[model samples]
Each structure stands twice: as C-alpha cells, then as structure tokens.
Target: MSEQPHPPKREIFDVPAMTNTDNKGFLRPVDEYRQLPYGLYMSRPADHPRFHHLESWLLPALGLRANIFHFTPDHRSGQRLYLDVGRFTGPDADGRWYSVDWYLDLVDVPGTELELLDVDELFTAHAAGLLTLDEAVEATEIAVRTLRGAAAAGDIQSWLDAQVGGRMPWLDRPVAR
Candidate 1:
C-alpha cells in the first residue's frame, strides 16, 4: 500500500505584540487571539509569579474581585512549543457546569506577560486540516458561546468566577528561592 500523506505542519499563531510596555506584565483579556490561525496553550509556569503577586499584593491592594484562569504566553518569539489537547471546566455561581477543551500549546517564554489564548481558532483550523483532529466530535463540539455571550456583556469575570472558581492554590505554594 502507498504511504499516507502527512498532515500539515502546525503554524504558530502570530499574536500581535502590544507596543505599550507600560502594561507588558499585566494579565488581561485579549479578543484578537480568539480569531488567530494557531493554537493557544495555557502557560501555568509563567503565571506562578504573577498569580502570587496578584493574590499577595495587587488584588488585595486595589480591593478588586476577580478570578484568573491559566495564563497563556503573550510573547512575540522564542522557544519550542507543543500542542496537546486539554480542557477547562467548572460551575457557575449558580452551580451550572460549563467546559471548553481544545488543543493546548505549551511554550517557554520567561518574563512574558500571560494572557488567555482563544482556542476557537484551533477548532476551526482542525476542522480545516491545519490542526489535527484526534476527537472529531469532541473537537467540533468546542463552543464558547455562553462564555462569549457573558464576556460581551462585560460579565466575563463574574462568569469565570462561576466556572473556574477560586484562586489556584498551586500558585500560592512556597517556592525555593
């Protein structure tokens, strides 16, 4: 039998870097990554320091109530990245459960500001053959409609709290200096 054709190589989504260094290290929501051509992986390691900083100083200092999900690398370059399927899920404040799973990319970008990388593009790309489709139905079923709807109404934080709920304890664990 003839050898099967290989799938296309994964392309890194070139998320535009912000020129304003003033807010370079802050974690914030980005709408553009939601429509990019590559996958977005959660950067848990990059989030460790900032997450601690947020819990220990920022949020408390400002009297702000917010919940942050896993951090996504927001750097312009460097490091080898890999894509693995993953899922994020939790209950809303009312106890309704919701979840989103997709191709999670992992990269090493020290000192990079971590932001959420939208995975809808991953689903789209997978559907189009730019990305792999290991679980066709599960991959195709990826939907953030409810999440986006709440986000559009400026209630993303509240929704995130309901879904992903509470501070990540791992971020608060003591680390050797």
Candidate 2:
C-alpha cells in the first residue's frame, strides 16, 4: 500500500501585511475575519479553477470547519456545504487562527444527503502513525455526532443554526446571479 499523506495545516493571521494560508500553503488574501462567540469566520478569494471565492467558519465547539465554495456557474457541484473535521485553534497573542485537518469530511447536498468522506484516509493516516489513536477516535466521534445532530434537526442548516444561535453569514448572502 502507498504511504498515507499527512493532514493539511491552515492558518489565518490578522495582520494587514499577512494573508491566510490554505492547505496547499498558498497565501490567499482574506476579505474579512470576524471573531464570533462560537468560532472564527473567514472569507477569501479562492485561487482555484472550480471556485472563485470561499467562506468558512471554524467552529471549535463542533470540531469542524464549515465551508461554502462560491463556485462558477459552469462548475457547480450541487454541494451545499463542505465540512472538514479537525482540530482548530486561534487568536493567541497575535490574533492568528490555526487548523489541522483530520482526514475526514462531510459533503452536504441539503434535503438529499450528508455524505461522509475520507474514512479510508482517516484509517490510513492512523495506520501510518500520522495520527494518534485518541485523535482518530475524536475525529470519528465528531463526524458521527454531527451526522446524528443534523439528522435529528432535519438538516445540516438547522443543526448548525441551533448550535450557533442563528443563521451563518453565508446563509444570508444573496445568491450569485
């Protein structure tokens, strides 16, 4: 078997001279960063072919980072939300945020399905000694709990709304024409 890859690291710095770095180490200019009660919210332009922009909320309480990809019309994937299970922290003395992906993800299609992804990647990483047993277990638990909560609440949006006390910023944004 091929060796499993290490998890990606993300960082967001508040300094005007600095830019948010993505998993690929690309520095992307952040349009905004809002420190919320539950977590940190970031919006930035994506330098990718599929999506023109990205908005994400790093919810530490949920152990998940939720993303909304502002895809170009021709590249729509029908995915309403993309969630990454991970360890997130931030805004220390310098007001910087950090995230380490745990190799698990959720693809929410809304009213259709909440697909769990990268189970094999999670297991492979654990086997390759890239993640501790405790970390792997925690990541699994977070994914399961999120699925269950979303199911019980009728949808991911409702589940997130309940957790954050209201609608997320992305939810209120006007649809692109």
Candidate 3:
C-alpha cells in the first residue's frame, strides 16, 4: 500500500465563541446513551470491583460488543474524536444485544492517549480501571457540548484550539487506521 498523510490537528478560536445549539447533531435523538451519573451508563465508573446494581445487569441485557473508534479530522476545530460503537448478542432467551459507543478526544498532550474500546474489551478495560464509564461519559459530553457550542457560535479556529487545548492537525490528511 502507499503511505498515508498526516491528518489535521486541533486549533483555537477567539474568546467567547458562538454556540451551535445543535445538541441533536452529536448523538441519536433517542438519547439512549445519555449519561445518568453515579455509575456506568453501561457499567459503574467507580473504583472497587463492583458495578452499580442495574448497571451490571445492563451489560448482559445489551450483549457484549467492541470497537476501535475513529473520527474524521475537522478543519474548523483541529481535533480528533472517536465515535466507536459496537454491539453484543445474548443467548436465545429474551433476544437482546448491547451497544457500546465511545467519543474519545484526541490527545498528544500530557496524561492522554488513544484508548482501545469495544463491548467486552472496552468494558473489561473499564473493569480494569483503564478510564471508567463516568469519565468516558463526562469527557464525551463535554466534547459534544463544546464542539457544538463552538460550531454554533461561529468561534474562530484559534478559539477552537484553546477549547480543546491543542492544534487540530489531524484534519489535514486522512486518518490512519
């Protein structure tokens, strides 16, 4: 195969940027993935080896799926985020399948890196204390809100950079696998 080019990175906008107000643009209308706080939207986000009650049962109900998420670069914002989604299939009984989605922001700065995600593997990572469901939800929620706000507000590229704390070079070339 041929060599791949570098994608765009994060950029910045001016102070007090515009708000997209298009919350619906990020996730589905159903809001099935909306955060409920406390424990996992799928499993608990706290420490210890215990998931929060209903949270634990949710995994089995949805079936375990996995995903290695990726996001196309955005020239406007200058960052990369994963929209990884997967599904799980359970036994014949009730006939259920679970879905796990991730929206990890790109990080080359300190204390950050791309994380692996999937149904069982992702959950296992969460179980291993890799990040935690709460962290994931909080971060993703911020990302969705921030980006939408910036887009809607018509924030300049410079403002976008400050919001994400990095240049969005990933938007230049195609994203690597």
Best by TM-score: 2
Residue-level lDDT tens digits of model 2 in 1-177? 376577555565553444687777777788877777899888888878999998889999999999999899999989888999999887678778888899899999966869999898899888888889999999999999999999999989789989999776773563242
TM-score of each: 0.25, 0.91, 0.23
Q: Kindly list the per-residue Cα lDDT of model 3 for residues 1-177, writing each as its tens digit.
A: 122322111111111221111112321111112111111122112221322111211122212111111222332222233322222222224322233333233221213333333334434445556556774454455445544544554442333344434442222332243
Could you tell me how far off, in angstroms, the CA of residue 93 lies in candidate 3 after the best superposition? Answer: 58
Clash pairs (backbone) in predicted model 1: 41-105, 91-162, 92-162
Each model's lDDT: 0.30, 0.84, 0.29
Q: After superposition, how far is residue 39 of candidate 1 from its true place, in Å?
A: 21
* Range of the 10 consecutive residues with the lowest summed lDDT in candidate 1: 55-64
Error of 1 at 126 (Å): 3.9
Task: Tell me the lDDT of candidate 2.
Answer: 0.84
The list of candidate 2 runs beyond 4 A from truth reads 1-3, 13-18, 174-177
Regions of model 1 farther than 4 Å from truth: 1-85, 88-101, 104-141, 165-177
Instruction: Give candidate 3 misplaced runs (Cα > 4 Å).
Output: 1-103, 106-128, 155-177
